[model samples]
Target: MTIHHHPSNETLATYAAGTLDLGRRLVVASHLDRCDACRKAVRGFEQVAGTMLEDLPPTTMSADALARTLARIDGLGADESRRASFREDFEPGLPACLRRYELGRWRWIGPGVEMRSIVVPGANDVRVFLLKGAPGTRLPQHSHSGTELTLILDGAYAHEGGRFGAGDFEEADESVEHRPIVSDDEACICLVALEGRLKLSGFMGALLNPFVRL
Candidate 1:
């Protein structure tokens, strides 16, 4: 599939530097697994980071540090290696970065819409979840308190900005406010990492906001 959207360069740089939070990092990883261009961009950022590190002054380390590090590396199992890339065997009908996560039951949030919470370690303010919208489903019009990262896994959706098909990545913040409607061809499934609350608009959204946890 042709990917029409991607995380911003700042976000990719942060991801390459290992500074992004777990939830956001997982979202980017999911996109990287599907988009070759983003993967190349991230690799370039990593190379830049490596060069910067090389220019820094060296620090003293314990005489046995190398051995200890090597031992730790050797101790890592197949699962650890798999996490470094995509693992097809981990789970079915889910993104590679999310295969290891425990997906909660799908709960109806609105007409033709369902949501499944993803159980992530070190649970914080970030809300990580899966959203499936049946054909022709129109989601609530809303913005965000902070950042919102969404990765389309299956099918497609469209809003004012553009159409987002499978493997597309969308990033929005408080400045964005639009309703997404699923394509009529099939259901749309998206992996989402949301920080802060959903600032739903309109009277209907205001009424639902109190009841909706997302």
Candidate 2:
């Protein structure tokens, strides 16, 4: 019921610019659903973008550029309704709604890490990946080649950006190698949208390489 952590400025900018992939967008949208502050920021960014577009000098563009821009906007609207409906159907955990998600049953991967990934509908390279981190444990250091979004469904994660609790949204940049310490009493459950595989760092991470596919 209280205000939670907001998305980074970079994330708000990317979402406004319409360059974020579907997987990541879902995370942002999910958080936006719960965080009013971030929802307002995203809206402000959109208004700024609209103003910038309106300010552009009238110039004839190559037909291709116009088509490409419109196509991108259209793509953004495709599943807005479906995703909104799906998200609205239930709270974060509901057996019936999860059965419709198609993410594999929860699979344990280590002493403290367990997850399942769901392929986003109509998306080719994007996937909705879930992770449950046991309390007092730290997630491995990993970096992404593309954008990644994380929404805390329950518990929390402490990283460079700071603590993120339930309803908090995080968008990790390409340059950020993320390492999050999980809360102690409850498992840190998160919904992440990853565009591609992750690159793990350090010795232990290397040892866990095969099993730690992002």
If scored against the real structure, what TM-score would every candidate get?
A: 0.87, 0.73
**Which prediction has the highest TM-score against the true structure?**
1
The lDDT for every candidate, in the order shown, is 0.83, 0.72
Output the TM-score of candidate 1.
0.87
Q: What is the C-alpha lDDT profile of model 1 across 1-214, one tens digit per residue?
A: 8999999999998877776888888888888878889989987997898799689999998999889755543322234437645544433567655766776888988778899988888648888998999999888889899899999999999999999999999999989998999999999999999999888888769767877888
The local lDDT score (0 to 100) that residue 97 gets in candidate 1 is 53
Clashing pairs in 1: none
Q: Write the per-residue lDDT of candidate 2 for residues 1-214, one digit (tens) a residue.
A: 5546767888777876777766676677667667778768877898898899899998888869978876665443434444434544233552222323556667877668998776567556877878899998888888888767778888887988788888777766578897889988888888887777777787757877788666
Residue 126 alpha-carbon offset, candidate 2, angstroms: 3.1
Q: After superposition, how far is residue 202 of candidate 2 from its true place, in Å?
A: 3.0
lDDT of 2 at 65: 96
Error of 2 at 44 (Å): 2.1
Query: Which runs in model 2 stand beyond 4 Å of their true positions?
Result: 1-4, 52-91, 94-101
